[model samples]
Target chain A: MIRLRAKISSSRGQSTNISHKVGTWSFSAFVILLLTVIFFPGLFAPYDPLELDVINRLQAPSKAHLFGTDEGGRDIFSRVLYGTKDSVGASMVIVLMASGTGTILGAIAGWFGGRIDFYLMRMVDVFLSFPYLVLAMALAASLGRDMRSAILALILVWWPSYARMVRGQVLSIKERLFIRAARTVGASNFQILFWHIIPHTYRTVGVRASMDVGYVLISLTGLSFLGLGAQNPSPEWGLMISNARSYVLASWWYSVFPGIAILLVVSLFIYAADRFSGAER
Target chain B: MAQLLQILDVNKTFKSGNSKVKACQEINLTIGEGEVVGLVGESGSGKSTLANLVLGLEKLDSGSIKFEGVELEKLLKDKSKSFRREVQAVFQHPLLSLDSRKTIAWSIAEPLVINKIGNSASRKARVLELLAAVALDEGTASKYPSQLSGGQLQRVNIARALALEPKLIICDEPVSALDVSVQAQIVNLFLDIQKRLGVAMLFISHDLAVVRHISDRIAVMYAGKIMEIGDTDDICESPIHPYTQALLSASTFTEESDEGREKLKLFRREEVPQKGCPFSTRCPHAIALCREEEIKIQSFASNQESSCLRAQEIFPNLAKK
Candidate 1:
């Protein structure tokens, strides 16, 4: 556990800013409860995600199925509920993998410089030259239309941005005295990077990761919508949207609810990122 | 005297495309054991470059440096950990010198932990002991560097430097960033540590008065070359080199005010030449020979040396002035 010393005290502007935002119960509750809704969907949802009812097809909100049923007689409410878990889980994994790989590689490059910095930055440039969507599609197409391929593609495309962010932070941070001080104390390269530089970079990394959650979620949904992710009948929200888009001309509820779920989750991530970054500054 | 530290004819020049930028000239100095050698010069005087070279942070273009009997270059050639363990550095900015993420306890213990000197329990104990030695409370060990004052942070830096039990501590303007009162406290701490440990110190500063107080010997540097080197009292009372005398006259001494302000100026303050004497442009007494010829170290008064063409001629004029 990192024992954080609140150096900028209550009297400081940062503390006041943190206090002002934290006092709003709605925002705080949304952030905390949103995680629970994503992680433990079964406890929160009224119906089983996979359950279907032919009789309730195209029906609006009622006592039995609050969100009504889709064109194929599947419950819109249950699928959206379960979709939260899968969507968040996949995006979280993508972010963790990308950020982890990127930060490590970036730290090595920035701290070592010379050949390491030159090579790693060039690699990032190569990846960045391709459009993210095109690269993800290409990867998903080649690897077969599976959830894993889509995730792998997204991670591959996403890592370069993190690498760039981390490298920028590292360049400035490595020049700091603590790193030199670490060297003066006979600290090995590994120890200095992990123990000294990483923690300093993490503040910016944390904010970036929080903000990237929205982007990752959008990318995952886009892939699923393109039929390159989460196979049909999986109760994934993006697949539900893809399957429901035709019926939206008649039964509007089919597409609207899932879209709202996506919006709320994305908005929450963006808002949370804003708050976290604000507090840090 | 048996040399504790010796830097011989070191020259370093940086390259930019076709041209070269001379950062340090052919410099030589020998400091003895248990002595505080003041490396005094203004900003961009190559004082820091020389310090960095001695610490093995930067490679010397030519010449060699030795600490005791061991060659500094040879020591740095293989394992620098031992070199760091023997010769530590305290940087200019105390705030920057410490890890903000770590607690004071952890930062101080880092050196001990890195060197693998004593196990976990003993290291923790040692950190607390060091904190106390620096006149800080044990409670401060758990606090981060940002929580402490500037003076407190510098003391922590000093404590960290001494943790490796280094033979020499290269303090690069360690007290310049602090309040004048705090400067005294830290300087006194250096003196106290030197008295207790008998550690040779390469005390680098632009402040002549502070250097005079702590140093046994002084070396005045300009544009990376040592203009004069002698015992502290000898250099202060009767400076042989023109640059050294000009520097002394300008500074406000503890005993007297800037009484000779009119005479306390040097004119050779142009951009340091690519080669030859860096102070030549500023030297009011520079002759035609000063421009073409690089001044070499010439013996003068007892245990004193001046790097000037007209050291003998300038000595009487400097004393009379």
Candidate 2:
């Protein structure tokens, strides 16, 4: 056992660990990219997202405008960059809300079992019955169309998925010896849920949240596509796409660039989530 | 030392639909301070159920368990947490006993933190001290349970159990999953802890060799009832009950060669029957009464008894063979 420990410790120190390096790089890059879009949107965009130039209207890519202009002469490139603050921002809120609600609810259901689990899961099933986009649209429509409403709608629609995931994880974790050990140590039910069961759920649910962000972004964009999301003149990527759709044939750069912006963010999230799972292993 | 733990006619039954299972039947025993008691049994013998009962993890259908004269059930009411701090357990598997994602320090310090033992720095210091006490070094504090060796993890488990300075530790097959060499290290670690700390224990295992090595007294169980209870050496040297003799004969190391192993089969036979004596169907001396009699515990000596009808007549003959 002593010799085996020595071997493991020494091997862990070697530089040839390719997977360890790749995971670190991928995670750091995701953080840097997200922060640039979130906190320094102006610094990254070359042109003002809302700046209008009459002569540049429906123009194809030129030397001045890298992503060309939309029907209203606004720089598509700038709008897409600025648009991230809302699209990604709302998606982040939705992911947080869903994962938080789901994990807590699921943990309770799985941990306690019996009647609590039965009724709570039935509620989850009711929420899950609605199609993701339709439910978000219905919620956004009922609440009235705006960024905050859209985010609220998305949160309401998405939390059940997290709850289901969390509850399954909680059920399995609750049976573990550590949980029983915690009980044996006189840790209160609150402590066992927060300290023991919740930590285990975090490992499982953290990976799911990152992936869920990509899905939530797609769903939020779908709401915007149906005219139930961000309205005119807003810099959100989804609303920008809606406004630029008419000029697609004449100048594909407008809607295409914002479309690609959504794609890039979603793909980055998925990639980061995958890398996170690998790093944990 | 006074009796640290006492169980009086404890019973447990599970009802599922129309059927019922008597998981534990009239279990009674006493454990003195710092004493190690072994409850040896096959699967489904209610040893684990008894452990759960003492821990207040399961409610008994009848009877009561007292720790220093306080009823276990009453102690479990609102202050189950305090009751737990006094009585700890080391489960069968190390992998299953520690949360996989948490660091060894967090796992050990959690109970202390929840019980509000000390400040963060003090808790960390205490955790490190616990790690050191379990023979692990300072580096292990940050390592996750999955990264630790089985024996190291078991030692960490022991450390966690000792963190609250529990008066009694119930070890349910603590070393069963480990390799033979690793098992001995864990067993020795347990023995050392018991000796230095003087904490009472109810050690549950199916391995008689391990039971013999650690237990001050042994309780052999079959079909949810204790067949024999006595001093460890007495149980090993002179097992009175036919089932006890059958259990002893069936274990390895008793017969030398394959021929002797074949010859030993006469003493070691099949499973105990479902009803009556439980061992009646397989007993060579079985008569109509042996099959019809509802076996009850009979006294052989003080603090020693065998629940076997034919114990007196068969004791001398079995010892000779």
Candidate 3:
């Protein structure tokens, strides 16, 4: 810990500022570029992702079609660029839901304790007992395969971990003397939980939420990859990859680019989350 | 002068497993307006438990605490929140008592904000005023608790307690966790605040010297019972209860030579006899009756009493206030 602080101080004393470091700039640039592609896919792609050209099926990379075309003759590159929206968007939504629900439950459970904590934490434990992907797949199968079902299943399988994390954080903080003093000062339980209590858990929750975003992306993509996500022709990255399975040997461009797209976006989030957590100490 | 607070036969008991621990047993005390009553005891002597009871942070198992004839629970039931604003507490641990994530300004302004004392502009003004009152610099308000020293954090804690202009403050070992130098400064600050604001206080501490310097009257406890209660000087010079005599003698042994040490021999603990005097197992003057019969509090002077059955026999010449 002392060494890290000394290294940070010495680096600042020298010429290389933290933001100007190569690793920081490159990671930041990659994130910014992914965001651009999500919000402005039209700007990046000349060809429409859904515009089918069955005539040019199984074509590899060329000048006119950089990532070539899928078996449906849809342009792979434009679709991959467009599919950035769901992979990033769904993960963010799931994280926000998980963190929000988890924090509230955890705060109440930890603060009030006794029976509320007992039942709530037990339920969380039950949800957590299952491996996340298996649970997500089971829920998707039961709820019927669609984007909304996939999201619902993911949120159900995910919120318990966040609830469990924030609950643990809140448990530690509620024991602080200020919380008891706050109660004495006539701050209602609501005010004490939110103002004096929950904010203390934010740093940990931020780190956890960042890490969860990556896991959510992976789970959603894996579900879609197994034909449980947005059905064919929607250009969602996972569905796109699933559609390319038959032509894998003939047209490696089809599965590989979309696969890289998923891998790149997931790592970007994980890296950001890792750095976010490291700075908290 | 009005009696500001009254704790009448207040009882609190905790069940550990099969047996019960009487945290506070039939405690009776009163504080006049602007009076500082120091309740001193060892770690398991229930001083903190009594502080919690008076603060209404814990529920009393059997008896009642009242402020100006209104019961504590009734005061809490009303929606006005006047009772809450009127009572505030400063805890022992400095850093633990202030929210680490919040700026000092926000912490000091907490009670005012919770009670809705004024609009944002006026609240900020009061926060600044309190910061000055606690002897903190204006720039200190912007910093988090971690950025400040223990003494600085404690000053902020005091400022927060003082924000509502509370009528009674419960200070639970507020300076025990501070340095010896900082302890004097904070104690003096507390005395100064009490003089200026005329807020009554229930100061709980295990330090006899700190209690003696600031308390108008002192109550000494042993095993969840008040062993001695009287005017500060009267009790210090001639403590009626053997427990108080042992305490005063113990403090003297720390500073003086071995000359007066044998006057009060410290008692060793035995099993707490549930039906008799709580101190019977440890009292040097204990008779068979003391171990078998319940000991009731005997009053001596104006508003002073002790639970020891031997109070009159031991200190017959003790002067009345």
Off by over 4 Å in 1: A1-31, A71-74, B17-19, B77-80, B254-263, B273-276, B316-321
True-contact fraction in model 3 equals 0.92
The DockQ of predicted model 2 stands at 0.63
lDDT of 2 at B231: 93
Per-candidate iRMSD: 1.1, 1.3, 0.9
Better of 2 and 3 by DockQ: 3
Per-model TM against the reference: 0.92, 0.89, 0.90
The segments of candidate 3 whose C-alpha lies over 4 angstroms from its true place after superposition are A1-33, A53-56, A118-135, A138-145, A271-281, B252-263, B319-321
lDDT of 3 by residue, B186-208 (tens): 99999999999999999998988
User: Over the stretch B218-281, how does candidate 1's per-residue lDDT look in tens digits?
Assistant: 9999887889989999999888888888888777774655553556566635777655677888
Best by TM-score, which number?
1
Which clashing pairs does model 1 show?
A: B267-B282, B268-B281, B268-B282, B268-B283, B269-B282
Model 1 scores a C-alpha lDDT of: 0.84
lDDT tens per residue, model 2, B110-187 = 789878898999999999888888899999999998788899989999999999999999999888898989988888
User: What stretches of model 2 exceed 4 Å from their correct place?
Assistant: A1-24, A271-281, B14-21, B250-274, B316-321
For candidate 2, give the lDDT of residue A199: 80
lDDT tens digits, residues A210-236, model 2?
A: 888898998888788778888878788
Docking class of 1: medium
Kindly report the fnat of each predicted structure, to 2 decimals: 0.84, 0.87, 0.92
